[model samples]
Target: MTRRPTPLKQWRLRAASLALTLPLSLAVAAANKPAQGDYFERIATFPVYHNLAEGEARATETVAEITTASSDGSTLYYTDSPRQRLGLVDIRNPEAPRPAGFLQLEGEPTSVATHRHFILVAVNTSLDYARPDGVLAVFDIRDPRAPKRVASLATGGQPDSVAVSPTGRFAAVAIENERNEDLNKGLLPQFPAGHLNVVDLAGQPADWRIRKVALSGLAKIAGEDPEPEYVSINALDIAAVTLQENNHVVLVDLRRARVLHHFSAGSVDLHGVDIEENDRIQPTASLLGKRREPDAITWVGPLLATANEGDYKDADKVEGGSRGFTLFDPRGKIWHESGASLEQALIRAGHYPESRSENKGIEPEGIASARFGKRQLLFVGSERGNLVAVYDASKPWSPRLEQLLPTGVGPEGLLPIPSRNLLVVSSETDAADDGYRSTLSIYRLGAKRAEYPQIQSDPKQLLPWGALSGMVADRDARKRLYAVPDSYYKASRIFRIDAGRTPALIDGEIELHKGGSSVDYDLEGIAQAGNGDFWLASEGDGKKRPNLLLRTNASGEVLREYALPEAVAAQATSNGFEGVAVTGEGALERVYVAFQREWRNDPAGQVKIGVFNPNNEQWRFFHYPLDQAPDGAWVGLSEITAVDDERFLVLERDNRSGPDAEVKRLYGISIAGVEPQADGTTLPLLRKRLVRDLLPDLAASNGWVPDKVEGVALDTRGELFVVTDNDGVEDASGETRFLRLGRLRP
Candidate 1:
């Protein structure tokens, strides 16, 4: 070393140089780096969409319509009739379609069309058959079925059919005439006339460009006389139709801003029309001889087929005769056709079943499960069907119908205890009912069904009782059923069930001071901790509601009731929190509760899951970001059993309005961190790991509005058993399915 700088002076120089180089190096590295890590890739998923129609029953005035579209054969759109909501079905794997989210609509929709990324819905506001209110709702469906309504316009007449341009800039609507009605008598309108409304939607914030256009002048055939009125322009197109009458296909140049051409269907009344691009056409020359099929022959270019409903004058006339569909070629030619009578089509579509009265349909609200011996069964509750259905899942997918039983007024949730072969159903009565009373029906598992001898179906034995919004199987020594009496009443009833016979009530009842809608026991989970004790969570309405967590005895007696901290209580609502789960054991035990705040201040407002420690009796609240709101006011939670001590599973049930309401979802929560300890003293520490959704992929999957998912148990096999309360009555299908989620090894 030259002059050998002193140790302090050398250190100071080195530190200065290091600090100066760090900033430059960091900046350079940040500029050249690519995005890293996989925060979005670790999502957990389950069966949230079930499309098994084999055992479906109609339980409501509305029915589900399954529509599919694809890109590279990937399902793009899935929707239902009544709610007119759209959902994205990830059909990259056709057999196991998964739901992404809901596609919002302006109003009830009659028809839908999807292009690369655009979705078109034809909305009719006039419910009266005599009056027609035509409207077009356009959406950006580039995200598949999760279409965003970008523009809406009112077409003067009622829109009966709709289609979108190949470029997705223009939307075509077929406006049906309003039935002429007498102003004074309020009768059906006679001499109804229909027309065509072509909307230019090329630009952003698309407005109805071509406000109104008459179909009469456009429908005039060259040789045929122009009728005084256009009875109906069911087939309206913007492709090959000439200005003259013979051309039935009418092509409107959206870019040119005028009517392009009109094509005739000979004497046929067109019902459907689809247009395709030249690249999409198949070679007709190869199928038929060149002489029979000329060059530029009719190919399936954006094929649009019209179903002829036939004239209403002849009642006996086969509705099918007029139900034929006219297929339009890309070259603008009427190429192929296929369709039965109108009545036949309706029946085939399940719109008009063979015997409407005889059909026992179910509007499934939610599904849950419980286990008996080695077998795990599912219980399904229907809001509209007013019943519950049981299924045997000794075998997966192929669940056999075990029993169809009746409950009280409107059964919403069903819970089963296989150890005792006991099942419980909870009902939320219609608001119109005087008492505002709900019911819980109790049942026993009986002999196996004769047809499926291996399946164990629950018996018809039922014990019905009145209550409020929630119910749970008491974990106390009494091992009774506890319920909230009513919205105003704070008292709960504890009914003891005889373990020897059919789970019948043997003990009287016990009441609690806490007044609320629902209660959850932490022990109701898949895995049992080393300690014999389990946690219990009870929720009261937030703001005006009270929320509490109680350390209870095995017999359902309250050992200690701790009021939730203000941070957690702040999230409570009138409906209170729906479900709760506890993770960790001994001193590390923590409880997570879900609060259903439907009309919260923000859309991102979450369902609250609060954590508490049994050892310290201390608590803290956390929130999870759910994609959508809970369907009903009541929410249910399972126990906090860990896949590993660091990761636990939490089950939740969505609420429903009634039997006909669409079913909601059951979510699986993964917890991280927090390990079990030899000493049961330090509270459990947990961080949310992942959220998994379970249900079908269809819009109708909402039909399963899970009430209170009460019973969560696991057998030695590591299969998770969940049970829900069916308010009462068997679903229309006369069967319910209790769902079981098998734990996967890490």
Candidate 2:
């Protein structure tokens, strides 16, 4: 029952059903074409924490990894490795998803596939990486709240991915006896190779038939390892498997339980790519002959699509991983490869993970395809970037990018339910310290605009940009602005932004250097000096350097430095300067900077706001009020700017992300006739006036609200701008929002 086609170059896809809304001719031209009818919108977010029982550590780590939907699309099931449990979510309303419950298991659950009324889970019972043992368990989900494990069958290897055939009579599991990266520096050739575990489900799992299809001796590179990573069974009962570490793809006939064909996934010479892991993203570098070490594999019509996670295994070369996805035919001939296009698109959205430059830039780790309405859609998940690229693949030969949807951290699984016109992503990363747990992001297709990528690099330049911290608009230009990068990169940079663009464009970088080498500064705040220069506030971690303010030219060359007073410098901790602004002029010119969080020698619920006079090199501060803290998170001022000589704007926020994010606002204060004391500790305090609640703007995009709202600037046009820090995409969605908060009235 295989629909295997000829070589990629020989086979041609007939026009998709003409019934589709748009003619195939025009559909091919769409680049994430504007959604016509109801486009996907994130109506609800369910943190896996809801599944933990009363006695369980609610603060403990839990994640929704591999997931599957009920045939009716009303229920969702996922595997949580850290908790060693299978979780359930109810999405009957599609607008508000809630956690149903969880079932504990003896081992870590790797993948889940649903067949009829049964839920099939591959559980890894391995005691060591060298010795792997797993089992395929069938659970009766008649009562989703209390799933009953009815049967279990032993397998020889650890399973990574699983899928049930559309016929509901076949299921395939990729038994990947994965490698021990700690051993021999993760060199391959570890034997007891892996393969596919096929089961015929005529009825209950107890009465099913099984077979193990060996995947060894197929690829020349690490052929003995045969690390099968993912599997997907198409409507024709044909299964396609990806041996990621082995750099190969295999297609099998489920009816006969035999391998039909296998071939190398091959390699490519990547150009215009970012190639460093030094906390910076420079997307202009190039790589030679990088292998497409794919991870997730999905069936797209008669062809197969793979996410090139770029998990290299060839010991000969130092570099591995192709930064995109590929489509290959049964003959193993490469049909189409995304190459650098995906990564480039990510850069424009300011979602590029610069911290992974030494490794794969943005790992396209998961792929899923579905037929919704008249359109065939393909969704690709970027593990590091924390977003999925959805495509209109109705016309197989020419697919257009539709939109990028933000997920929680490490989106390990992608699920598409065409029946309900819904898309789901299972993010696997859990945050214990930040109160933000792993989440299940649900998107339903409807008549709504894709409200993401609010900020991106210019399409022409595609300047790789992320980790935005400080923001300052041009003094004269109405729509021009500049943003500062946080400590994610060793290089301190100022990015030019044309806020006028639909998706604000980052024109290019203005490198900050001292003596030609990049300056080592944790820049958190910036203010235009109006003299073709900017004043920068560096947030010293106390262990590294003292908090200081510096002035730099348009080229980002350091011109002057203003060291903090000895007493103030000694009082500085890790949470020092967070924002800076220039006020007054000439002799009366003064610079203002905000201190993040409370430090030593401060009263409870109050922090210092240092005010500096550049002319006299003198410093004074005012007591800034701190609000009541969240349950377990801390609150602090992330940015401050002078709205005018009499008024100044301050940004107060909490250090929490996603649903846990609550307070993000702009407060106003005036220094009108306020007496400044010589002693920094004796300064008077000022009451804050509410100006704007930024929570609405953040939620308007239908994306997760990030914690680090570290920049706020009032431009000469009376308009205000805000920017968020993405933390270098490290445990972050890597989404930087550059917002133009239209002219402030006060």
Candidate 3:
């Protein structure tokens, strides 16, 4: 029997939804549903690199763009445009997907779909923008192991999307005669207009014939060049198509091979959004009349949903993209619009791409809808944020945001299989050097609640935050903790978190300031004082800034700043002052600051730990031994947490992610009777013992293991917590794994 969430747990989930900045209606709807109801949980992440031939170089660029599942839901197929191939994955056991090799295609596979035992691949064989051409290649996958090419038909032009009708009578292809951005700045009307191609799927594959349906002169903007981007066929033999670049939506009667209705995708005035690339997440900017250039469309029941992923900007600097998704009726009446809420929710989950703020926030690109038993589910993929926002579409008019699942970089495909209770997402971006390989993530629907968004802020406050670095638990509060963001943002802040909840909540924040003016610091470490104040350790840039220890009041007002002694500061490097912790009280109080790496004068395999005495205002140093890092990688201290007056814990990790990582652990040190050197010269080496190995905990998430395990804290009841730094989502996966290590003895 499925166990329902208790009243307290339900309240926490509701508060979490609000904290995630979900739409008000969505929050209420999600909270009111039975807790034991259906929900999707991520099961596995299959990297496309694994699909390469056994001896082939893994570093070779590969991507999984558009994906589709077999009718039996036993196998997965995706397009690899860069390699001009169709990759396969056997997901008979959805929890552990295995690579099933790949099939080389003649041209770039733009899209993929499955009907019965046939795999339809849209191959883009276009020579150029003026001369666009493509083929719909069909492969018989009846054997499931070895698929053979059966037949191929010429699509009217470059086909971007293909969909088979529910009755398997016909198939609709969006022949997008795409334009070249280099020519005329990619301005519209660049040649032959695009149209819809309907293929008769009756009889055999060789008997199929394409029928062109003119879609020209149907949109207000760039009507002569209608570039259809995506298509979805409903049960009534109707096709819903999205002309992304032209900002238009069109409906076609597949049975008649003619256009039924077309309407402008329109524009939206987005407010409460961040529209700057200024190294901060301030949602105070507004964009007036931004075009909703919907890229992907799907039919949910009788309604249509669009993922408005804008791609063009006019000469007047009129940008595209409404930063969200929209649900509309057949006649183009807006039934529900996500507006800026989705982007805001990504912000709360630390997945918002701040660098893309000036262009498109999150960029909802691919959308798919499927019915699981009695409930309808909608999945919206974020291209920039690298995640999918799942919604309950049981009520088509008012969809409820249910959960957000992390994906690979640039998710461009969303495929749901209700029969197998699985959803597959495919990513397009392939950057082997950056540790972000193209991947296909699989999720399964079950009774368990979401296990992501481990930390979030209150929606009522609408706090925009990310790049969490240091953490410190309150002395009196059982579940209260404090965390600080690194130099990712311009404003330095200390956030208050409620650690008791299953998915922790950030309930409040205090921006650091001095004399009515904000002060920005690369704060990597934080420690709470007995009087409720905070001690922060700011890292130096090695060029202009020097490492320093700062004291702040409970209200986040800086009271004092103590630079490293002149002699000690001269030997500092860029990786300095990573962690800070305080012990004792009054005159006996001593501050411990951990330097991340070896300094100019320190010996190899040892970093200095600066000790400060508040009573005498003197400084001492101790050398901490470092572990040997993997080749081309460096190990360093990330955090320090005080266990008591005599002992403390320090986080040590390597600058490697995914499968390359090796050193994510905690070390214990005691200063009960040891004496430190007065200066860096011949510093005393401190003895350390292994506390815990955190690599297993991070690997249990079924995703890539993040490298920046930069935060650690111990609460009053012996609960230990940890957090990772996402590098502000710049060339990174933007996944923060907030882990609780339960009770521990230092």
Off by over 4 Å in 1: 1-531, 543-545, 567-571, 598-605, 629-641, 652-693, 697-711, 728-737, 742-746
lDDT of 3: 0.86
Candidate 1 per-residue C-alpha lDDT over 495-573 given as tens digits, one digit per residue, 9 for 90 to 100: 3332222322223334432233333321212112245333444547555446665554434455567776564355445
Cα displacement (Å) at residue 618, model 1: 1.8
Better of 1 and 2 by lDDT: 2
Instruction: Give each model's whole-structure lDDT.
Output: 0.38, 0.80, 0.86
Residue by residue across 390-420, what tens digits does model 3's lDDT show?
8888776677889889887888999998898
Position 477, candidate 3: lDDT: 92
Better of 1 and 3 by lDDT: 3
Query: How many clashes in each structure?
Result: 120, 10, 0
The TM-score values for the models, in the order shown, are 0.33, 0.92, 0.94
Q: Residue-wise lDDT of candidate 2 within 175-223, one digit each (tens)?
A: 8888888788788877668889898888768988889898888888888
Residue 745 lDDT in candidate 1: 26
Clashing pairs in 2: 32-401, 32-402, 38-446, 38-447, 39-446, 276-357, 276-358, 277-358, 279-489, 310-321
Which ranking of candidates, highest lDDT first?
3, 2, 1
